[model samples]
Every structure is written in C-alpha cells, then in structure tokens.
Target: MNRPTVVRTRDELRNVLAPARRAGRTIGLVPTMGALHDGHLSLLRAARQRCDVVVMSLFVNPMQFGPQEDFASYPRDEERDVALAGQVGVDVVYAPDAAHVYPPDFATFVEVGGGLTDVLCGDPGRRGPSHFRGVTTVVAKLFNAVEPDVAFFGQKDAQQAIVIQRMVRDLEFNIEIVVLPTVREPDGLAMSSRNAYLSPDDRVRARALNQALTKVLEVAKAGETSTERALAEARAVLAEAGIEPEYLEARDAENLTPVTRFGPRPVLVAVAARVGRARLIDNVVVDATPANEPMAASVDTTGGAPCVGRC
Candidate 1:
C-alpha cells in the first residue's frame, strides 16, 4: 500500500506534485473538508481510475458558510481522513489551513451572475448572498493551486455542481468537471457529512428524502405527466416521515432549472427537507417519454445549455 503523501501548504503541494504535472500526467482532484466517508472514497476511486495521479483536497472552506451556519462545529477528523485517503489510493492530499488559504486582507470573489446564483444557492433575502460566491472563489483557487486536469464532485450537491460547471465554462479553467452519482446508505438516505448532526429519529426520517424522490420516479414511470401530481406524492411521503420539505419538484436534470411540464427531455425529481437540524436532499432521474415513444431520447443534464439540469 502506497501511503498517501500529505501536503499542508500551497508550496508543499506544488513541490510534491510539480513533477507529475510537468510530466503531462492527467491529475484528478476530489475536494472536500476532512472527515472522509465511503461516498468520498467512491469519488477517489473514480479519480484514480481516470487520471494518472489523484489529489484530494481537505479544506473546510469557511467562505461557503453563512453566518448562522455551523462553520465552527463542522466536523473535522484529519488523522482519520488521511488514513482513509491512503487506503483509497489517493496520491497526494492537500490540507491547508484557513489562514493560509485566505489572508486577512483577502478581497475578490467569483460570482456567477445572470440569475444563475440567484436561483438555487443565492440568498433570497440577501441572507446567503455570498454562499455561491465563496464556493466559486475557493474552487477557482483550488483549480489554480492543484492544476488538475479533471475535478470530481458528487451529484448530491446538484446545485453546486451546476454552478461549478458554469463557472468552469465561463472562466475557461481548462479543467473537466466530472460528477459522480450520489452515494447512499442502504436505507436510501444520501450520504453527507452533515448526517453526523442527526439524532437517531432524525436519521431514520432522513430516509424520507430519498423515498420521496423514489415516489416521484414511480409516478413518472407510471405514465403520469402531471409534474404537480408527482411532486404532491413526494410531499406526502416526506410529510408522513415527519420531514419538513423545503422543495420538491421535477426539473431539467442538467441545469437545476424547474420544469413546469415534462417532455422528451430527462427530468429530475428532486427533494430537500429538514429532518431535525440536518437538511437532506436527494433526486432521481425519470425519462419524460416512454421507450416506445418516437421522441424519446436520453437527456444529458451535464451537457449543453445552462439551467436545463435539476437535482
């Protein structure tokens, strides 16, 4: 087993991986805060298979957190994460401190304007207005620092993936954004670091997030064309499970845009709900048209056009 090398600062990371980058090695990056899990390991495996070298970034980005968000209490288990990264075949781990990444007088942020940020992650009441801005800014910094040929993100963060994809295109980062399927627990709950905050009952109720999306998929498969009806079924499932649904809708599976009517394009039935203090989200894609239908064709949510994909 090749133990993964840990690089704590930008200078150390560059010094360690500079040779590989110069040799034209295709590097893949999986960025996450510490506290590694099976879902994150799945991403590392995917990166290992596709790229010559894999770099996993373990930085708990404070910029992405809102004032009321749990930035202080966000989980951190560096030793465990480092051990898991080695087990999962990560070549190098970039673990940088907050002060190192962001200086005291740091200014400038990446903001995806034109209503993109305003839709999903934007602060409706200017509450989290800087959320996506922080995300894009840090991601941009990571891209520059690691200089990976490709980056991997999880589908569980549908909006973040969409926003990052758009950012890459707009900024011309020359990096491929590969999104992996959402890994879930056996009970269908999407895996998330935040799950640690859930109580036992809340953890059980969290499964409703996936269950609701599954119900929507069933309805769509049953020839139900009414998006409202499909969403209603999902809402009922969540309600029965004692989860307060924040949003339940079918949308373009690629851009995270809401779709009023289903067509031949693939639609994503997505749900987000709060089970106690944990906010859980899940989604399933459904074919808008039957296989026998003439116009039926698979949709690529991650490809072409913006605002067409949903989570």
Candidate 2:
C-alpha cells in the first residue's frame, strides 16, 4: 500500500507539492484536529473523489477556543491520524505545529465583521467575541498554504461552514467550499473528536443533541410552521433528556440566517448542547413541501443520502 506523504510545515508542504500546484492540479483539503475517525474518513473520501490530490490538515486551532474551553485537553494522535488517512487514500497530510503556523508576532486576522460573526458564534456580551474570528482566520491561512481547489467541512459545524463560505466569497478565494453531512453513531450521537471527553453516561446523554434536532424536523414535517413552536418542542425533548441546550432553531441552509416564516425552502434544524464537558451539535435538513410534492433529488455534498430518518 502506498502511504500518504506527511508534510509538517508550510515550506515543506509547498516544496513537496510544488510540482502538482505548478501543473494546475485540482487539490482538495480536509482540515481537522488530530484523532481521526470514520466521520473524517468520509470527508477524505469525498475529497479524493473530487480532486486530483488531497491534503488533510491536522492542527488543533487554539484561537477558536475560549479561556475556559478545552484547548489543552483536545485530543492529538499524529501517528494514528496519518495511518488512518493513508488507509482512506489521502495523498498528503499537513500537520503543522502552532509556532510554525502562527509566529509569536502574528498580528493579522480575518474577521467576518458585522452581524455575520455575531449571529452564530460571536458572544456580543464579550463572552467569546473572537471565536469565529479565529476560525475564519485559521481557515484563510490554510486556504493560502494548501491552495486547494476545494475544501471539505463536516456539517456538525454547520455555522462554521456557512461562515467560511461567506468569507471565501467575500475575499474572492477561488476555492469551492463543500459542506458534508454530520456522521453519527448508531444511537444518533454526532461523531466528534471531542466525544473522547465524554464519560460513559455523558456519551449516552450526548444522543439528546441528535434527538432534539430530529424533533424539530418531525414538527416541521407535520405541518408546523411556527419557529417558536418547533423550537419549543425540541427544547422539551432536550429538557426531558436533561440536556442544557445552547441553541435550537431552524434557519436558511445557505446563509445560516434565522427563518421567521417557513415555506418550501431548504431549511436546517440545528441544535447545540453540552453533554458533560463536551459540547455536542447536530442538524437535519427539512424540505417543507407537502408529502405529495415531488422535487429534485438533492444529494448531500458529502456524497451521502440526505438525513431523512425519524426524530
């Protein structure tokens, strides 16, 4: 088996892949913190299918985490991640250390500026203002370093993907931003690297994240249009499971903007909640047209079937 070549710094990565870049190859990038799983494999596979070469980034970004967040505890397994990426046909792995990516005097950042950052990730009350800013900044740096034709992101970070897409468009980056479906466990818990932090009981409680989002879809499919009503039902489901919800609402899939009056648009029912120390998130897209109404079959960009299961 041909193993994927691992590059540890931006200069090494550029040197190794210079020929491919010069040849105008279509490259795909899958960014993640170390600790690979089947969910990440799905993104790698999607990238493999779509591009001539694939680059997987394994950097646990510190800027995205708050002071009280688990940045220090976030898992990292480089050897395992490389082995798994090779097993799934990844061509190159870019695992850069913190100092290499961000020098001590690094002063620039890519901020989405205005309501975009505030709506989803920003804490307007000065709680976590730079959270999304850090995300966009690191992603912008990665895009510049790897220079991939396309980048794949898991939908478990739905708002993050939307934010990045907007950034790419606003900044005029010539890359396609592909959002993949959230891979889940058998019991409906969304798969995440942070899931490693969960105790056995916390793991069981984590399923409520998926269940609550599913409840929103159930209510929407049953002809419930009120966003308030749908969110109320989902909140009740989470409460029943003893989960404290961070946010649960239906919104336009493209913009991540809240939807007040729901009609036949493609809407996403998203949920975020804490299960022990780990924050779990999951979402389901609901096509609000009548049951008898036939629409075009839309496949998830992740190359999986659209999630249409019961709540």
Give candidate 1's TM-score: 0.90
- Residue 4 alpha-carbon offset, candidate 2, angstroms: 1.8
Candidate 1 per-residue C-alpha lDDT over 81-166 given as tens digits, one digit per residue, 9 for 90 to 100:
88898997999999899999999999978888755566544636532447788788888999999999999887777777778999
lDDT of 2 at 78: 86
Clashing pairs in 1: 252-309, 252-310, 253-309, 253-310, 254-301, 254-309, 255-308, 255-309, 256-309
Which pairs clash (backbone N, Cα, C closer than 3 Å) in model 2? none
lDDT (tens digit, per residue) of candidate 2 on 1-311: 45889988899998988999899898999988767766788888899899999999988888877787777887878898899989889889998889988899999999886455675446464225588888888989999999889988877676677778889999999999887777777787777777888999988878777777777766766778787888888888889889877767778877667886566677767776778877766777766656623212221223321110101
lDDT of every predicted structure (CA atoms):
0.75, 0.75
**Whole-model alpha-carbon lDDT for candidate 2:** 0.75
Worst 10 residues of 1 by lDDT: 302-311
For model 1, the stretches where C-alpha displacement exceeds 4 angstroms are: 123-127, 289-311
